[model samples]
Target: MFEELSQYLGWTNCFPEGESFLVIAEGTDCGFILQHFIHTFLKRKLPVCLVSTSQTFSHYSQAGIKIGANLDKAREEKSIHLVDLMSKFLNHYTGQIECDWNAKNIYLSIKEELDSMEISANSILIVDDISVLSSLCLSIDDIGNLLHYLHALSKQRGFNILMSIPSLDCEQVQDTQSIAEHYADTVLCVKSLQTGYSKEVHGQIEVVKGGRSNCGVRQYKLSDKNLHLFARGTSMAVL
Candidate 1:
C-alpha cells in the first residue's frame, strides 16, 4: 500500500530491532500512518500487537483489508493480536483479552499474554491514540508512569512499540503527551499538507526525534483507501 513511502524513507530496513517510536498526527491522518507502519511490519512477518483505545477491532480489520493485510487470518495464525480497550467505546467488551479500562490493568494483561506466547521479545505494540486515555480523566502522572513502564518493557524484551498522539493540545493532556514523546526511541509527526500546489498529497511526516540519519519531511497522500508518499522537491527537513 505504501511502496513509494517505504522507498522514499528507506523504511524497508530502517526500523532497527528493539526500537520504540512515537507518532503524532492530526485526525484521520493518524490512522493512515498506523496502517502504513502495520503494513510494513506484516511484510516482514513480524508479530504485531495493537492496543486500541479509540476504535473497535472491526474498524481496523476493514482498514487492514484495504492494505491486503488479512487480519482475520493473521489472528487465526497467531501472527497478530488486537488488545482492544475500546470495549466501553463499542458499548460492550471487545478486547480479545478483556481487562479493566485502566493502564495498569491493560499492561498487566498484555505482559501476561505475551509471556505465555513466548514471543514477548522482538515484537511490535501499536497504540491507537494516547489522548483518549486523557479523555478517561487519567492524571498526567498516571499517563507518564504508564509510558515509563511501557518503555522499560520494550527494553527488557527486544520489542518495539509505535504510539500515536495529537501534536496540538492544551493543559494536562499536553503534559502527558510531552512525556510520552520523551520516552520514545524515535518520534514521527504528521501534519496536514503544507504545500498548496498539489491536491494528490494530503500531508507530510516529520522525524521530530531520533530517526535514521538524513530522515526528513516527505509529501504524503492519504485517502479513504490508501496512503502514498513522494519525495520532496526541496529540502524542508524538520530538523
Candidate 2:
C-alpha cells in the first residue's frame, strides 16, 4: 500500500520530490496514518507541517523523538513542524463558534507560518479535519478560500499539503472534497466496509481523483503505531 501511495504521489525512489498529496480518512485516527506513511516510506528527513484542530501532536512528535533517540539517519533526516489552528483560535472561546477577531487571528497565524516556510521545497502541511474548523466558524465559501490559499502556497513553494475531512459530515465533506478534487494534485479516501454478515471492518482505501492510473480499492489496517495496507486478497481486523 505504501508503494502504491508513493507511486500515486509520483515518488520514483524512496524519497518523493516535489509532489503534494491530500488524504481524507473517515475517522479519528487519520493523524496516525499520516505519520506512519511519512516515516516508513520517505525514510529521509523532510519538513513536515501539520495544521490541525486537534490538540495532540504526540503522534508525529513521538515519531521524531524515537528516530532521534535511535540516532537513526531517518530521524535526523526529516523535520516535523505542527500548527494547531483550532487550539490557537478556540483557546479563548469556551464554546464552538469562534468570533470574527479570533478567526482573523488564526488566519494571520497560518499565513505567517506559510510565509516563513516559503523556501523549503519538501515541506508538507497536514490539515487534519477541515470539517472541525468549518463547523466552528467559517462558512463554506470562506473555507474554500482558505483551501485555495493553502493550495497556492503549496504550489508556489513546491511542497505537499495533506488535508483530512470526515466522511459523515456530508455538507462539509462534499465542500472540502470538492476543493481538494479541483485544486489538489491527489486525493486518497479511507473508509470502512462490511465483508460479510458477521464481520464489519475499517480497511479500505481508494483514490478518488488526481494523477494517472487508479490503484483501485485496497485493504488497510491501523494499529497504535501505523496504518498498513494489504494487497487485494488480504483481510484485516477492524478498529
Candidate 3:
C-alpha cells in the first residue's frame, strides 16, 4: 500500500508468505504500521486473523476505512476474523469479577480461532500490541512463551505472523523483546527521534531482515490518508 516502504522492504506487490514480522515501537504507537499490513493483505484478497489486545474491531474498521480498506466488508466476507482481547478483558474484570492472566489461555484462544478459520500460506495473524499483556500482570517469560507458541502455530498452519510490542526501556533490551526478535523473519523497529519531535518528521523506522546484510532505515511522517517515508536526513518540509 505504501510504495516507499514497499520498495525499502523489497516487497514488490505483497509481503512474503508464512514469514514473521515483529514491530517494536520504542516510544510511539505503531498501530498505523499494523493497519498497513491489514490493508495490504486485504488488497491481496488474503484472509486475516486480527488478535487485538489493545483495540476494538470497530476501531480497526474505522481506521481501515480511512486507509481505503473496508474492514467491515472484509469481516462480512469472512476474510477478516477478529479476536477482541480488550473486550474479553473488560468482561472478565466487570462481569465475572475475576482475572485470568494465564498466557496459555491466550494461546488456546488464538489456536481455537485460527483453527475455525480458513488459512493458507498467504494468510496472516496480526497481534496489535502486546504491552497489554504485561499490564495484565503477565510476566515477561509468559509473554515470550505466548509469542513463541503463536509463532509455532503460524508455522504449522502455513500462515504469517505480524506481532507488535512496545519496548519499555529503549536502552535496555529485555529478554521478552529479544525472544520476539529472535523468532521474527523481519523486524521493524519504530523509534522516536533522539533529537526530539519535529513538525515534518514523526519518527524513524529500521527494517531488519533475518540473515540479510542490508537493512534500511527511513524517517517517516503520518497523514490521515497514508504514511510518507523519507530517506534518512531528508525532511518532509523539503518535499
**Cα TM-score per model:** 0.83, 0.74, 0.90
Candidate 1: give the clashing pairs: none
Q: Which candidate leads in lDDT?
A: 3
lDDT of 2 at 126: 72
lDDT against the true structure, each candidate: 0.72, 0.59, 0.83
lDDT (tens digit, per residue) of candidate 1 on 78-176: 787877667754553344453345668667766765665535455788888888778666678778878888889888888888898886657776786
Q: What tens-digit string does per-residue lDDT give for candidate 3 at 12-121?
A: 75568889999999888888888888988889898899998888999999988877888998999999998888888888878765657688999998888898888989
Clashes per model (N, Cα, C within 3 A): 0, 3, 0
Evaluated at residue 130, the lDDT of candidate 2 is 73
RMSD of each: 4.6, 4.9, 2.4
Q: Which sequence of candidate numbers ranks them by TM-score, best first? A: 3, 1, 2
Q: Compute the lDDT for candidate 2.
A: 0.59
Off by over 4 Å in 1: 88-102, 194-198, 211-213, 223-227, 231-239
